[model samples]
Target: MVLRVNGLFGWVRANDRRSIALFGGLILAINVGAALFLLLPLLAVDPDHAPVTAWGGYARRYVPLVTLAAGAVFALHLMRHVRSVQRLTGFAFVDDADEPRLCRLVEPLAIGMGLPAPYVGVIEARALNAFACGLGRRDAVVVVTRGLIDALDDEELAAVLAHELAHIVNGDIRLLAAADAGLRLVGWLARPPAARRQQVGALLSLPVIMAVLPPLFVFILIAGICGQAAIRGSRLIRLMISSSREFIADACAVEATQNPAALVSALRRIDGRSRLNHLPPGQDAMMIDGASEGGFATHPTIARRIAVIVAVTGSMALNAPKRRDTRSPDQRDRAACAIRTGVFGAAPPASERGTPDLVDPGDARNWLGFTPVMTLGAVLAVAVFLGMHRHDLHRPAALAAALDPRPAGILLAVVGREFVCNAAFSSVGLALRATGLDRPVGCDAAPARDLAAAQTSGSVGRFLAALTEPPAGLSMHPNGTFGSAPSPATEAETVRTRRCFRTKGYARGDGGLHAVDAPPRRDGAFDIGRWLAGAEAQAVQTAAAGPEAGDRPLDDYLSSRKSIVHAVDRYFGEPGLAMMRRSFASPSHQRAIGRLRERLGDPRWAAGLPPVRRAEFTLLANSPEDFVTCSARDRMDRKATVPPT
Candidate 1:
């Protein structure tokens, strides 16, 4: 337990350090930029301001002083009323006398985390959720809903409390509150009605804010409304900070409790329940759960988090079956049903329902490492690209001077196509050649125009065909009107002369990239407005899980993970998955993958593979030099077919 706790703590610290380092660097850069912004405006205020030519000296003297002064003031007021927001939203302070057990639970945990006890608050929410916030451990507040208190068992409750306490000890609670407030204010001011009026007010008040408060507050305000990108960027950064924070906090909780099972149990129970809470944007992050599987998400998926916990603990950690809930059984059942529908939505036809776990998916992951495309397609792409667009590349002034005569857009589009295609092909070729493996890479879908093109042409072929051909009009292609395939392959069955790899999700029986006419499940009865609405909310209805259904609702939901493509993207994003794939590509990777695939039986391959996956990642990490580039003579000299470039 001690060793597990220490390891989990170390993981927590590492993720915290990485995420915080990035957040800190961004904050420092923004502050420095803010100081420079204030300089010119401040100079204008000076009665005897330095002339434009001699302003360097003035800036050097004034910038640092103003920056420091403003930052100090902003730090104080930024998170001042954070707790009040929750209180005003109807959370009541918990009296120790009234809730001795809850207070008692927090005290020991706070002591373990080396922090003063946090204030506890309770919301009347029926949803099971809780979060922590404060300037630091000393004044931290852990807020829970009445439902959460009622729902979680003692161990689960302790786990939840420990998690929130972990947030306080981490010193992220306060920073999160400040950032959320800053970002929310920006979003509010960016809307049209607040446009010039808000801008004028902020600018006019800058002098007073700089003089009395911290210039940091002014900086944050300015950065918030800098532009749409700035506002969005801030929100994204904040969300990332929040996302990584949850993982660290979970680890910290495990360490504090020395029980990963409790946390996992709590997470699973709370996962779908929290959706019904009327949480504010900022508060949603602090909660046990919300929309955890999207781009602008606050937390990683509940299953992923649980898997991570299992990885950290090296234990099954699946709680002994819970003494199921009794009161409001119908309500619980309905919540579960809604969650199943919302998270998984409807399954596509059996043909489209299952995507295999391949070494690579859809040639989308590493565009440059694919072997089949690179060796055969890259040289051709370069020739075609230059031949078709060399005139435009040579014409420097054409963009500004040419009055729509040169077909510049067409030329640029083709160049982009060539560049993208070759990059994909090159990546494939590099991976194969590096691994000393000569394999074919082509889609196995029936020969539709695009599928045919995909099979024979470079990665660009499929992409271009999807855009221009029938059914799957992925996007508008310039090739439809302007030019033809420079080296078109006949629309015939692309034979698998070489070894073709399967991506995990898209691996069909034939093992090809284009298994369908269109990209996954976006086929059949597509309605513009309803589709958009459903995109935001997967409100598909599901019949009650019964004997005939022969499926666990939760399992179905987990299997059909929300935002399928986004989920796939995450697997690609992980270093562990990449390492595992790279290892599978070369003999070492390939052999390791073979053993691994045999061990991991079919069905439910995507989920809960984290433990073994992490072990493989560990193996790779330990012997990194062995896998770095598959040294031609290091050990496999006898079998080195193609040297790694």
Candidate 2:
């Protein structure tokens, strides 16, 4: 027995060291990964943007600082979580005055183990469970549910107290507390951005949406990936910390009490009844019997624990457990249905029975009892919203100016610049400054130049001109309207004009002119409202002109609207541009476009067009509303086709 005990002690020592190392390594990896994630976008954009020395310096300065900060935060969070657990479990520290029997049971066990008597507490729960928690020996606490005390005999109760005392003596309490804290910290950090959904939805202004969404989405994606990794890593660490400690504690309990039979009996009584349904998840590691059972279970099964105890102690009682409850059905049902009424005449409602009143009255859920932490989160959210909207807030005049189309366009351009060029440079600059590598770069001037060019260029006017002008192969009729097909001479001119337009950056699908002089603003900056308004006006005018004018007026207006839609597409770098080009090159699209032009030129050619030609023409003749609706539908269709980052 002595040899077996010594071997278990040795194993415990080695496993403890391994658990600590794994936990520290996981934290270090997380800190390093965070730093790298921050720098990833910059590196992806321009690999040679920063020097090797700069990166090395960044690691040397910030990695340690970040690790230290993380440690400090974890420590604070762990302490707070410990207190929260105590509160949530409705356990209060007791003395000889509050519970003479419980204190008397634990004090002797502590003395026998050559450890200070840890504080004793009682949970109001009727569940048969117990757990030990603390930072260290001095502040350690052992808590038992009332159900446990009432269910077990004096010997069995002493064995359970001895088991908890073993945890304190072996320093398992501290490790368990740390594991609990880590699991919660990772979960809270990695939680999806549901709180910000309302804020994002409230951003009705186009400029605000444009300015905020890119960075916000980037943050969410990176946080989501890192959060999942952290959560998994924390769980693995908790499992490692907990897996062996329970066995060692169980073994120690038998050794301390010198009565393996008592523990075996206690285990048998407690096995299925130990799970506390009111207690939150992730507390399984600390409980006498885990609240859950799975492959990833923190505690060894009760049967496995009994077998080990028997092997080490050679206790015949453990191997001979064939006892069964002999109570009558009525008596058993009454015992099972018993509820603690405290000092009251009858038990409160089921929902209000077990848990204690939370420190915060506003906290309706026991799980979210950390009111101060929630307040801090709310403050952080407000700060982020304010930071993102600083541009709009500081320049209220710009928002009012947006009512005018030209200012609105310019304001959009500015926001786009901030989103794309300025934000990138700012992030890089902050990183460089942190690393003491803040040297002036030529790239600093690029955004300013782009903003200036956008402000000066008559791109909107050129866009409108491109939309209103008729495409080649169409001729003017005697009524001063364009609705006639070209002559043979004009057909050759038409092909030449089409070839020239294609070379000048016109998409064949809609004959929309792309701005070649100015670089395409990939940051969605177009004035959508202005375009929609123009389309609506054109639709009204076409309606007033009536069917007497044939489809000539309708065709002209639709074609113009399509041109503007494609121009916006071009501005946003035309997602799926390659697919669009391939489609336009197909023989089917060619025939469809030819038939569409004929139908536009002669309203009476056919009362209705074929589905293929109609669909193709619809693509080229949609108003702003139709364009938006189609774009949304197409995006949904192509959602699966988009590659994962």
Candidate 3:
């Protein structure tokens, strides 16, 4: 236990140092840009200012001094707030049974090291992913995805879980969260809104400030660009930090479990199965897949990871386990039942519910590097283009005289530049919604059309879609035309009609357009409105309430929750059961069957019929668990596949 704790603590220290070093260069660069923002203002300030003359032109200047101070404060405030946000996001945990296993592992390790047990939670996702979150050891939570649980056997699962614990112990979670927060802060600062209002206010106070302000603004803009560049440089460093942490975690996990073979085999199988296509950026390092290059992604390559595990242990079992032949039964009834269900025709007994010794995380790996740089590069490229246009706006009169049709090049340039910046901002906005941080203003479903397009297509896709599509129709009433997907004209009308109140924010009388001043609603109210209504919520609640019947055991609950796809592919895939065949006629039909099939995995023992079906097969429940009551009307069949009344 002491050893585990020390190991984790040492890991955190090492990880932090590496991360700090990686991001150090970027921070310095950002400071340099920020420093310019401060220094230029001093130069702009009057030479006669007291500070200028006080020290014989040494330390007396004020504007630059003040600006520098202000910039620092701004940066610091942003850093602090963003850190909190990142930490909070990391702290979110899923409440489930797997959490106990994590606690068990961490507890022993913590006891060995004289540390407290860390909080553990499950993420309700199919993706094989996991991450540790907290500002520090005492504050952290380790979250693993359900897909990971379903994928890895025991030893492998333990390895991945241990790796995350190592991150918490080493302090990698806090460090990375801090770094991400800083980057996000800097990006937010560089946005036009943060500065635009200030610039306008400054102009209002002293119109002459505008005269030299453009140059000043230009300088600040360059500084902002440099700041972003620094951030990118910092991210590169953090990647290396993450890699080293992975190495240490692997070593620590082996030491803790004393089962290097499990870790090695886990890595081997996980390496082959991982995918990189759906990895969410910024959080890639936290995933078991570690990008795609094996571990070199966020950790290192699987080869490197495996080699380390092997070196730490001794020669592992080289022979692969014999593959089990597909089951063949003479009776058509058994085969048909298997086909009608999923891969797992029946739930494994409770004792066999989980692998006791697996050591891998999962197969989905992230090989691609962190992309903050790419995003920054794109933003800078657009800003530079826009700045050039601003220069054009200055010479619009000259260009007008040169060309017959007054050169709207300046107009085009300004619009184009602003468009890029706005698009980027909008993309960020959409991501916020997806992450459940905030909702878009004045949108019924938050119009997330741009967000949807981005997710389905790509960032560029989102930009193009937004560019081609007109502003969404505004609705004065909650259930107005804009509530549903409608014609372009209706969309246009909604936008036009609601344009007046769009400025008012989300109020009852007007459409629930969000107030800019308010933080995004956390209840996911906007999306909830779009998806679940009174009837929908009631229905879901009723179903989720569990078998209207009676008491159910743990095994029944676990099995019932398993995906029907697993059972259907296992049972119905065979050429026997007519009912199962009719159910799984199409992939879409198969998916529908899978959803319903999940409930059947549970054994409603309280109803007390026969033990064979209860022990060997799962029974459908009204909700998560029920022994007696079930919705006779198949909800999936009635609503999903069949027409509604």
Candidate 4:
């Protein structure tokens, strides 16, 4: 008979440490393999050549470049993941009002572990569960279900936060993310799909194969079969191996917080509640399941996790001293202050407030039916185009080769690019959605007005119509006029309330360009404030920037705009800021800027900047020879222009 509790508190700590060490060693091995795979090709090209003079030299020259590109892509993927997590977590009914109190409890524990305060979020589900997600500490998000919040008191909550912090500290997320991306690339590269029929003519050419001969045929066929099998096997193995990381994380959490009972209690509650709130499957490891052990389990069983935690801490609880607020004297004053400020007053009526649509048009459920058809249409369209314009098929192989830039790499690269790019575009569609409901019945785009009059159509029909038809008067040009500017009365009221930043309007024309008006602004010197302030200002604009900004009440506009702008700014700020910054940079800065200039294509801005020159320079001391080779310090004086790619 096994002593379950004893096993829980015993052996887990040691096992977890060992697992972590193993993981680090495995990662090192992976890096070594990557290095070798990259180097072997160059070696095979010309072994007789000097190692430095040969492919090794080229590899060395481009390793940094490759690393930078890969790193940037990974960073972008992680950022996207965080945003997705935030949105899904925010949507759940968890009350954020208690976040400060929750933070207060978790902060001490975080400090005890030398970690930054973990972001705490609440979901409005009755599941006693929590998960920590982010690529790293600075970007992490902690989401706790409503049930978890309701079930666990302060101490337990701290314990849960500590456990998640352990995951962060161990860099579990980073490791898992790397593993996932690597496997995906490997899978993509291994099972390269064939191009369409027209594009496959070259592969079918008898003479082309005759030139390459039986060796090429034998190699390609064998590699294709074996490579696909290996990739599939690797994926399954990766999934299996990854589950152990969860157990290791549980142990790490115990070490970080030095509390076992709290975690155990939280687990008991979560298990009992049995309320399921699944995040995207890709993010399952970040959830509370420590050892998703079964069908879709990404972690081990709770019992095993508890055992691990118990083994490490040995029944000791590392409880920190709680803050005691003994401010009896200030109670009456606080009550009086609240009354004076009207903070305790009755809630405002619904009509007085702004309301966002109950549904979002681009939500996965709303788009689910249409997306498949749209995607199939896109694929079929590409196939049809390739078939009809068979002459154009000549480029696919060359294009594939260029994209992959390696022999036989084209097939894999093209397939991956198509899938990834399409997914990215789908995400973009989701990001741009404004409303969920369909246009009202009889609400067709009136040709002259470009506006659809609201009627009583079902939400789905209106949504479809909105996508299929352009509004009547809306010009798809980005620079199209936004009618007249707001009147003085509207401007004064908006400015007084400081809601100008988001009140601008935009209409898309047939060309798919959005013609937007000048967005409202604060009295600040710069365009937009920091993210939070910008969000507030934008919401104010969205509420007020409707049919008659010139006539709408500033109060009503402020209320309405607040909700819309908050989401818009949260999602769109970085790109928006880059756009705005490009619009107003000094001439010298503009000259130095490479990609920014090309993207903005503002002729005036480009013309204003001084021309950059490329020069070869040599350094010499006083009375020294003019042709002396420059040392690193001498080269510092020279400014080399980076050519825009």
TM per model?
0.42, 0.49, 0.39, 0.37
lDDT string for model 4 (28-59, tens) is 33333333334324333322221223546545
1-645 per-residue lDDT for model 2 (tens digits): 233445445657777778779778567545634454444343333333311225665666666776687678668856665576665676767899987767878898889898888888887665678888877788788898767766666677888888888888888887776666556544554444432344334233223323333233334344545655665566667766776787778778878877778888899878777766655455567878883354345676788777777766674545544333333465344435643322111222345343532221111111222133333443455455456546766776543332223422333433343355545657687776777553334333332233333342132333323333456756532212244554323433433332211112333335443443345356734544345456556555655564567656546664654565555555433443332343334444344344445555655453365333344344443321233223433554577689888
Ranking by TM-score: 2, 1, 3, 4
State the local distance difference test value for candidate 3: 0.43
Q: Model 3 over residues 374-429: C-alpha lDDT tens digits?
A: 33433454454345345455676532332221112222222333344445557788
lDDT of each: 0.49, 0.55, 0.43, 0.43
Look at candidate 3 and tell me the lDDT of residue 550: 34
- Model 2 regions lying over 4 Å from their true place: 1-7, 29-58, 192-223, 292-296, 316-446, 449-645
Ranking of predictions according to lDDT: 2, 1, 3, 4
lDDT at position 391, candidate 3:
49
Every candidate's CA RMSD: 36.1, 25.2, 34.0, 30.4
Model 1 lDDT on a 0 to 1 scale: 0.49
Model with the higher TM-score, candidate 1 or 4: 1
CA lDDT of 427 in candidate 4?
A: 61
Clashes of each: 27, 0, 66, 35
Where is the poorest 10-residue window by lDDT in model 2?
Answer: 360-369
Model 1 error, position 641 (Å)? 99
